[model samples]
Target: MLILGTGDVRQVLDGAETEVVAAVRRAYLLHDQGRTALPHSVFLRFPDDPRNRIIGLPGYLGEDEPVAGIKWIASFPGNTAAGLERASAAVILNSMATGRPEALLEGSVISSRRTAASAALAAAVLASSVPETGVSLIGCGVIGFEILAYLRAVLPDLATVTVFDLDRSRAEAFAARCEARWPGLKTEVAASAEDALAAHRLVTLATTAATPHLSTDACRPGTLVLHVSLRDLTPESILAAVNVVDDADHVCRESTSLHLAEQHSGNRDFIAASIGSVLGAEEPYRRAEDRVTVFSPFGLGTLDLALADLVRRRAEPLGLGTRVPDFLPGPASGADG
Candidate 1:
C-alpha cells in the first residue's frame, strides 16, 4: 500500500487547478452518463454534539482506469476556535482486480480542491453569461479561500471579491490574504452577509451555519449563488430560486437547504437540473436573467476518487508517497493458513 501525506498531496496538486477542474468535469460527465456508482454519504453524529460529524463517502468511478474508494472525513466546527482546521479526511483506493487497498491518501486537500473545482465548473456552465469581474463569499474559511482560488483559475476576468463572516477579524484576514495572493485584486470585507450577497452577481455561501439563516431578499434578479455550505439558505430561498444540485437524492437529505425545501413543499419539483445534467446537455444551460439561480452540490464521492486517482498517478512517477511493502499479506502468506 502506498501512503500519501498532506504535503505529498499538496505537491502533486500545486498549480494543478486546471487539471483538477478537468478531472472533476470528467467525473461529473461520467456520473451523468450512468458510468459511476455513488451511494449516499453516511453521516455519523454524536448525540451530545449535533454540530460535529464524520462522514464516509464511498463510490466507484468507472472509466478506462477504473478505481473505487472511500473518503472518511471528520468535521469538528469547534476546532476552529483552537486554531485548527474544521475538517480533516483520509481516502483509501482499492484495486478492482483484487479488491485490496492500493493507496491511502490524506484527503482534506483532495476534498477541498475537488469541491472547489466542482463549484468552478458549475459557475462556468451555469453562469457563462454573467459578468465575472467580481464575486462575493459569505464565509471566510479554508473552503472559501479554495473556492476563490478555483474561481480565479476558471474566471480570469474575476478582479474583485467581497467577503463577509460572523468573525470580522477572519473576514479581514481573508481579504488580506486575497490581496496578497493576487497583487492587483481588490478585496472588500463587507459589513454583513446581506451586504456581501448584494455586492456581486456571483455569490458563494460557505458558512458553518447549522440551519437556515439567510434569505434572498438582498440578492438581485440575476444572482448565481454557489451554496457550498448546503445549510445556509432558507427553504423559501431555495424554492424561490432556479435550483441546481449535484444530485437530487443526495442533496435532498441530511437537513440540507434543499431537503428542508422538499419537506416544506413535499416535492422535489423545485430542482430544475443537476450539475452533471447541465454539463452533459446538448445545449448550453441558459440562466434566467430575471431569477436567482442556486447551485447546491452534495459533495460527490466520485469527485474525491477521481482526484485521488490523479494524485496517485502523479505521485507514483515522482516517487513521492511512502510505499509499505507488507501492508497486506501476500497470497503465498495466506496459503500457509
Candidate 2:
C-alpha cells in the first residue's frame, strides 16, 4: 500500500482550482447518471463525547480508471478550543483487479479541496447572473480559507469580502488572508451574523454552530446561499426559498437544515432540484427572480473517491509517498475449496 501524506497531496493539487472543480463536476455527473455506487455514510459516535464522531464513507466512481475507496474522517468540534484542526481524514483506495488496497492517502487535504470545489461549483451555478459587488463568509476557519481560495480562482470580479466569526480576532485574521489573495478586495468584519448574511449578494455559511440559527427573513430575494454548514439554517428558512442539494436522499438526513425542513413540512416539496440537474441547464430552476437560492451538499463519498483517485494518479510518477507492498496477509483462499 502506498501512503501519501498531506504535503504530497497538496503538491499534487498545486493550487489548480479549475482542475479541482472539473474533478468534482465529474463525480457529480457520474452520480447523477447512476454510474456510481454510494452507500450511506456511517457515523460512529463516542458515548462519552457526544460532540465527537468518526464517519466512514465508502464509494465507487465508475470511469476508465474505475476506483473504489473509503474515507475515514473524524470531526471534533472541541479541538478548536485546543488550537487543533476540527477534522482529519484518511482515504484508502482498493484496486478492482486484485481486490487489494492500493493506496492510503492523507485525506484531510483532499477532503477540503473537494468540499471547496463542490461549494465553488454550486456558487458558479446558483450565483446570480447579475453583477455582484462582494461575498460574505460566516465562519473564518480553515474551511473558510479553502472556500475563499476557490472563490478567488472562480470569481475574478470579486472586489469586496465580508467575514463574521464569534471571535473578532479570528475574523480579522481571516480578513487579512482574504486581502492577501485579493489585494484589491475591500475586506470587512461584520458586526453580527445577520450583518454578515446581509453583507452581499453571494453568501457562504461555514460556521461550526451545532443547530439552526439563520432564519428565512435573513436572506434577500435573489441571494445565492452556499449552505456549506448543513445545520446553520432553520426549517422555515429552508422552506422560504428554492433549495438545491447534492443528493436528496443524503441531505434530508442527520437533522440538517433540509432534514428539519422536511420534518416540519412532512415532505420534501421545498427541494427544487439536485445541483447536478441545475448545472448546465438552459432554463433556470428558481422560477421567481425574487426567490433566494440555497445549495446544501451532504459531502458525498463519491466526491472523495474521485479526488483520491486524482491525487493517487498524480502522486505515482513523482514517487512522493511511502509504499508498503504487503499490507494484506495472503492471496485468495477459495482455491482450497
Candidate 3:
C-alpha cells in the first residue's frame, strides 16, 4: 500500500489547478453517461452537537484508469475556535483487479481541491457569459480560499474579489492572504454578506450555516452562484433561481437548500438541469439574461476517487509517498502453523 500524507498530496496538486479541473470535468461526464457508481453519502452526526458530522462517501469511477475509493471526512465547525481547520479527512483507494486497498491519502486537500475544481468547472459551463473580472465570496475559510485559487486559474480575467464572513477579523485575514498570494489581484472585505453578494455577478457561498438565512434579493440579475456550502441560501431563494445541480437525487436529500426548496415546493421541477447534462448537451445551455443561476453540487464521491487516482498515479512516478509492503497481510503461505 502507498501512504500519502498531506504534504505529498499538496505537492502533487499545488500548481495543477487546470488539470484538477479537467479531472473533475471528466468525472462529471462519466457520471452523466452512467459510467460511475455513487452511493449516497452517509452522515454521522452527534446528537449532543448537531453542528458537527462525519461523512462517508464511497464511489467507483469507470474511467480508463478505473478506480474505487471512499473518503471519510469530518466537519467540526467548532475546531476553528482552537485555531485548527474545521474539516479533516482521509481517503482509501481500492485496487479494482484484486479488490484490495492500495493507497491511503490525506483527504482534506483532495476534498477541498476537487470541490473548488467542480465549482470552477460549473462556472465555466453554466455561467459562460458572466463577467470574469470580479467575484464575491461569502465565506473566508480554507474552502473559500481554495475556491478563489481555482477560480482564478480557470477565469484568468478575475481581478477583484469581495469577501464577507461572520467574523470580521477572519475576513480581513483572508483578504490579506489573497493579496499576498496574488499580488496583482485586488481583495475587499465586505461589511456584510449582502454587500458581498451584490458586489459581483459571480458569487460563491461557502459558509457553514446549518440552516437557511439568506435570500437572492441581495443579488444582481444574471448572477451566478456557486453554492458550495449547500445550506446558506433559503428554499425560496433556490426556487427562484435557475437551479443546476451535479446530481438531483444526491443533492435533493440531506436537507440542503435545494432539499428545503423541494420540501417547500413539493417538487424537483424547479431544477433546470444537472451540470453534467449541461456539459454533455448537444446545444449549449441558454438562460434568461435577468435570472439568477445556482450550481449546487452535493460534492460527489466519484470526484474524490478521480482526484485521488490522479495523485496516486502522479506520485508513483516521483516516489512521493511512503510505501508499506506489509500494509495488508499476504496470502497465507500454506496452512497456518
Candidate 4:
C-alpha cells in the first residue's frame, strides 16, 4: 500500500485543474454510459448531533483500467467555529487485477477539487455567457475558495461576485482571498444569504446548514444556482427550478433538498436531465430563461477515484507517497499450504 498525504495530493493536483476537470467529465460520461457502479452513499448520523455525519461512497469505475474504491468523508459544521476544517475525507483504491488495496489517499483535497471542478463544468454550460454577470457565493469556506479557484480557470470573465457567510470574519476573509486570487474580480459582502442570492445572476449555495434555509423568494427568475452544498434549499425552492444534477438517483437521496422535493411530488418530473446527458448531447437543450436553472451535484465517488488515480499515476513517477511493503499480510496457513 501507498500512503498519499494531503500535501502530496495537493502537489499532484496543483496546476492540474483543467486536466482534472476533463477527467471528472470523463467519469460522468462513463457513468452515463452505464459503465460504472455508483451505489447510494451510506450516511451515518448521530441522534444527539444531527448536523454532523460521515458518509461512505463505494464505487466501481469499469473500463480498460477498472478500479474499485470507497471514500469515507466526515462533515462537522462546528469545526469551523473551532478553527478547523468542516470537511475531511480519505479515499482507498483497490486493484481490479488483484482485488487488493493499492493506495490509501488523503481525500479532502481530492474531494473538494473534484467537487469544484464538477460545479465549474456545470457553470461552463449553465452560467450566464454574458461577461460580468453577478455571481454570489454563500458559505465562505474552503469549498467556496476551491470553487473560486476553479471559476478563475473556467470563467475568468465573471467580473463581480458577492459573498455571504454567517460569520462576518469568514466572509471578509473569503472576499480578500477572492481578490488576491483574481485581480479586478469585484466582491461584496452581503448582509444576508438572501441578499447574496438576489444580488447575482449566478448563485452558489455552499452553506453548512443540514436542513433547508433558502426559499423561492430568495431567487430571481433565470438565475443559475450551483447548489454545491446539498440540503440548504427547501423542497419548494428545489421544485420551483429546472433542476440538473450529476446523478439524479444519487442526489435524490439522503434527505437532500432534491430528495425532499421528490418525496413531496411523488415523482422526479421536476428534474430536467442529468448534466451528463446535457453535456453528451450534440446540441444544447433549450431551457426557458424565465425559469431558474439549478445544478445540484451529489459529489460522485467515481470522480474522487478518477482524481486519485491521476494523483497516483503522477506521483508514482516522482515517488512521492509513502510505500508500505505489505499492508495486508497473508494468512499463516499459506506457509503450510
Candidate 5:
C-alpha cells in the first residue's frame, strides 16, 4: 500500500483553509441529500485500562469519486503526560472495484483541519443573522487555533476573540500567537467559562475535557455554540438550545451532547434539525428571539474524504507527497461460476 506520512498531509494543507471550508460545505450538502453512508463508530476498550478507547470510523463518501475509507483513531488522555497527542489516527483507503487497500495515510491533520473547517462553515452560515460579533474559544489547543484561522477566512467581522483554557500557559501562548496572526482582531484570555461566554455570542468548545465544561447558565440568549469536543456540554445545556447536528443519526449515537439529551429526555425529539437538513434547505432557519442555537458534529468520514481528496489534488501540483506505483490491481478477471 502507498503510505503517506504526516509530513505529506501537512504539505498539502499547509495554507489552504478556504479550500478546506468549501470541501466541508460540499460534504454537508451531500450528507443532507443522503448521498453518504457512515455507520456508527465501533469503540474498543482496553482490557487493562477501560479509559483507553480506540474507535473505528468506516464509511464511503458518495456523490462522485466515491472513495471508501476507514480511520482507526485512538484516544488516550494519559498520552499527554507522555508527550504525545491525546488522539492519534491512521486512515486506510480502499479501491471500490478491487476491494484492495490503496493508500495508508496519516489522519491527524485530516481529523483536525476538517473538524475546524466544518465548524467554521457552520459558524459562517449561522452567523448570517449575527454577523457582527466576537468568538469565545473555550479551549486553545491545535484544533482551537485552526478554527480561529478558518473563522477569519469566513467571518471577517469577527473582530474579537475571548479564550479560556484550564491551562493558563497554553491560553497565554494561544492568545499571543493569535494576536500576531490576526492583527486586526483583539485576543485575550478569560479567567473562566462564564467570563468567556459573557464576552461573545459565538462560543466554541474545543477542550479535551472528559466531562462537561460549560452550562446553559453561562450561555447567552441567541448564542451559537460549536461543540467540537463530544462531551463538553451537559444534557441540560443541549436541551435548552435549538439543537442542530451535522448528522442527526450519527451525532445521536456518539456525541455526548446528544447522548445526554437522549438519556434525560428519553427521546431524540428535542433536536431541532440536522445541519445537513438546513444545508439541503429541507429545514429552514427560524429566528427565535430567546433560543440558544447549537451545532454538534460527530466528525464524518465523508468530510475526511473530501478534505483528503482536496489535499491530494493540491499535493500533486506542489510535489508535496510521494508518488508510488498502483497498490491495488484491477477488478477480478472473471466472476465465479
Candidate 6:
C-alpha cells in the first residue's frame, strides 16, 4: 500500500482549499443525484472513558474517477490534552478494477479541510444574509480556523468574526492569526458562547463536546447555526431550528443533535433537510420566520474519499507521498476457492 504520511498530505493539500471545497461540493451533489451510498457511521465507544471514541465511516463515490475507495477516520478527543490533535485518521483507496488497496493516506488535513469546505458550501446556500453580516464562531480550534478561512473565500460579505472558546488564550491566539491573515476584518473574543451567538447572525459550532452545550434559547432569531461537530447543540435546540444535515442516515444515527431530538421526540422526523439537497438544487434552502436554521454535518466518508482522490492526483505530479509497492500484491484473484 502506498503510505502517504501526514507531511505528504499537508503538502498536497496546501494552497488547495478552493479545489478541496469544490470536490466536497461535488460529493454532496453526488448525494443529491442519488448516485452514492453513504451508510451510517459506526462508533466504538471506550468502555471505560467515553471521551475516547472511534468512528468508522465508509462510502463509495460516483463513477467519475479511475478509482474508488472507502475512508475510515478515527477521532479521539482526549488526544488534545497530550499536545496531540483530537483526532488521527488514515484513508484507504481501493482499485475497483482489481479490488486491491491502492493508497493508504494520512487523513488529518484532508478531513479538516473537507469538513470546513462542506460547512462553507452549506452556508453559501442556506444563509439568507451575506458576508457583510459576519459570522460568530464557537470553538476556535483547528476546524474553526479552517471554517473561517473558507468562509472568507466563499462569502465576501464576511467582514468580521466574533469568536468564543472555553479557552480564552486559544481564542485570543486565533484572533491574532486572523488579524495577520484576514486584516481589516474584525476578530474579537466573546466572553461566552451566548455572547458570541448573539453578536452575529451566522454562527458555527466546532466544539469537541460529546454532549450539548448551546441551545436555541441562547441564539438570536433568524440566526444560522453551522454545526460542524456532531453533538454541540441540545435536542430542544435542534428541534427548534430548520435542521439541515449532510446525510439523513448518517447524521440521524451519530449526531448529538439528532440523538437529543430523538430522545425528546422519540423519532427522527424532526430533520427538515440535508445540505446535499440544497447543494444539488433538488430542494431550495428555505428559511422559516418562526425558527432558526441549523446545518449539522457529520463529516461524510465520501467527502474524505473524494478529497483524498484529489490529493493523490495532485501529489503524483508534485512528487509527494511515499509509495508502497505491491500493497495488494496480485489481489484476491480466486477467493473462496
Best by TM-score: 1
Report the error of model 5 at residue 140, Å. 1.8
lDDT of each: 0.94, 0.87, 0.93, 0.87, 0.81, 0.81
RMSD of 6: 2.3
> Which digits, one per residue and each the tens of the lDDT, describe model 6 over residues 97-189?
776788889887888999889888888888673333588999988899999988888887788899989989989998999899878888889
Tell me which of candidates 1 and 6 scores higher on lDDT. Answer: 1
- For model 1, residues 75-135, the per-residue Cα lDDT tens digits are 9999999989999999999999989999999999999999899889888889747567999
Model 5: lowest-lDDT 10 consecutive positions: 280-289
Please state the error at residue 129 of candidate 3 in Å: 2.9
Q: How do the predictions measure up, each by TM-score?
A: 0.98, 0.95, 0.97, 0.95, 0.91, 0.92
Clashes of each: 0, 1, 0, 0, 0, 4
C-alpha RMSD values across all candidates? 1.1, 1.8, 1.4, 1.8, 2.8, 2.3
**Model 1 poorest ten-residue lDDT run:** 328-337
lDDT of 5 by residue, 1-337 (tens): 6677899898778788888888998888887787888888898886778567888888887866787888888888778668788788988887888777777778888989999998988887665365746899998888898898888888878889999988889799999999998787898899988898778778898987666667857767888888888788888888888888887777776548788789889999888877776766744465344877888988888788777667665666666655567655556689864
Write candidate 4's Cα lDDT for 102-186 as tens digits: 8999999999999899988888876553543568999898888888778778886778889999998989988998898778888
Runs of candidate 1 exceeding 4 Å displacement: 332-337
Best by lDDT: 1
lDDT of 3 by residue, 113-192 (tens): 99999999887877546556999999999999999999998887899999999999999999999999999999999998
TM-score of 5: 0.91
Clashes of 2: 1
- Pairs that collide in candidate 2 are 1-324
Which residue runs does candidate 3 get wrong by more than 4 Å? 128-130, 333-337
Q: lDDT tens digits, residues 146-205, model 2? A: 987888778878778899999999999889887887788899999998988887878899
How many backbone collisions does model 1 have? 0
Residue 140 lDDT (model 3)? 94
Q: Cα miss at 223, model 2 (Å)?
A: 0.4
